[model samples]
Target: MTILVSGKNGQLGHCLVDRLNFSDLDYISLDKKEMDITKYDETARIIGEIKPRVIINTAAYTDVEKSEIDKKDAILANESGPENLSKICKKIDTPLIHISTDYVFDGRSEIPYKPEDDVNPKSFYGMSKLAGEQRIQENCDSYMIIRTSWLFSEYGKNFLKTMLKISKQKKTIDVICDQIGCPTYAGHLADAILKPIKKISENNFDSGIYHYAGDQECSWFEFTNEIFFVANNLGYIEKIPNLNKILAKDFQAKAKRPNYSVLDSSKFCKAFGVNPSNWKESLPDVIKSAVLA
Candidate 1:
């Protein structure tokens, strides 16, 4: 049986494909064009035909601000899409490994969020993602919901890439400092997910929500600072932009973000014996790749 991966064009999907290419695993990766999860009949048709042993879903409506304006699209992609996948996975008796976000929490807690923590999402994007998690739990028996935060990589549109682009055009950049979360490297997250695919496929592992992110927590300003620092050290950037620290309240965004959304990954680490990504150590290579790209 093959391992099916969705969102093939996404950063996480790209990373997963890279790892799967070298491994002795038989897998098929599909982008939205091949299999749009939001369409039930289409998704069911494709998945039923493939009959994969395991399905990894990385597709999501991730634009926080855009979600506010395009509520229908966000709900369809984030909630209905997962609902369709869960129902199909259950029908085929295939295990699902779905990616989630830490935005499900309201960020009122001073400590890191646990898998079992109560969720009170403050934004439509967060609410839709939370709804997706619920749909999977209700529809599928064998599923793993991995909630991560602050994803950055050389590929795709993310904070690190945005900062890199802005540094070239502007000498000063203002970033929100009040909000804090772990910075996850997409490549590392893909590795962490792939490590347990065998066990999940064999029904040897537990199925539930898990947290996986960077070990360190920092504000967006700090993350940008580190990005520039790494880029400068690697000679990727001619000059580091002057990063101004601004509070979340001061930032005029359509969506409200959590003040602190750090996730506690002890459960995942203990279960998989894989530590969270060390984004600081991984930043240099990511910057190097982004520069060369």
Candidate 2:
């Protein structure tokens, strides 16, 4: 089967490439330089040339804080670009696997955000991604919109890498303890992306939105502390410091992030007949790989 992966350099894209290396699938992966989805003509041309049975769109403008000032660029990349890709996929009648985020919800609930929950984005970044979801739903018929959260990987600059860097330079670091969500490893997300595609090819399954993320959730402070603890044990860090806990509002940012962006993965698990490992269990491999790198 011919499958195309966009955002080849991003966290999930990189993970997908590594995971699918030994699979019997013809995959064409492209970074932004190879195919810019922002241009509809370019997107159409590339999709037509590749003729992929499934198009996995991992590309996104993910700078939450910076998006407040760069709304135009954010909208172009997040909303308009996905729309273009959806249109192209629709034209060819190929199934689209688009990645979305938990930020589409307002983060006000005590329970996890379900797939059928109402969307009330609190930031420009969230709004832009939500717009992308809307565009894809309207334009494409055969598509799987997966809403994930707190994605990190060894290939790119992510939260785990940032904390490790900060720990190396400073004796202490302050992280928000109030905001709670899963620290989804990109490799796990890559696996989640592949599951439905295999199902589609084997069973000709119907398409819809699903939430795929790490099994458990935690605050930013807890997640950071775990990173440093693992790093110190793995000899990646010399010593651990006082990890300070702060509230989300204490950290000044241009964008207003969701306070509780945790998503319910029950729907995804049921659809694929697989339950992903929790973040804590899967985090060790990510740390091990990052340490080795």
Residues 1-293 of candidate 2 have per-residue lDDT tens digits of 88899999999899999978877777999999999889999889888988888889999999998899999999999999999998998888888888999989998899998889999999999999999999999998888899999998887889998888888899888899999998888888888778668666433766778888878889999999888888888788889978899988889877888899889999888878867547777666788787677
lDDT at residue 51 of model 1 (Cα atoms): 84
Query: 136-167 in candidate 1: lDDT tens per residue?
Result: 99999999999999998888899999999999
Superposition error at 269 for model 1 (Å): 0.9
Root-mean-square deviation of every model: 0.7, 1.3
CA deviation > 4 Å runs, candidate 1: none
Candidate 1 steric clashes: 0
What does the lDDT come to for candidate 1? 0.94
Alpha carbon deviation, residue 231, candidate 1 (Å): 0.3
Per-model TM-score versus the true fold? 0.99, 0.97
Residue pairs with backbone atoms closer than 3 Å in model 2 (clashes): none
Deviation (Å) of 89 in candidate 1: 0.6
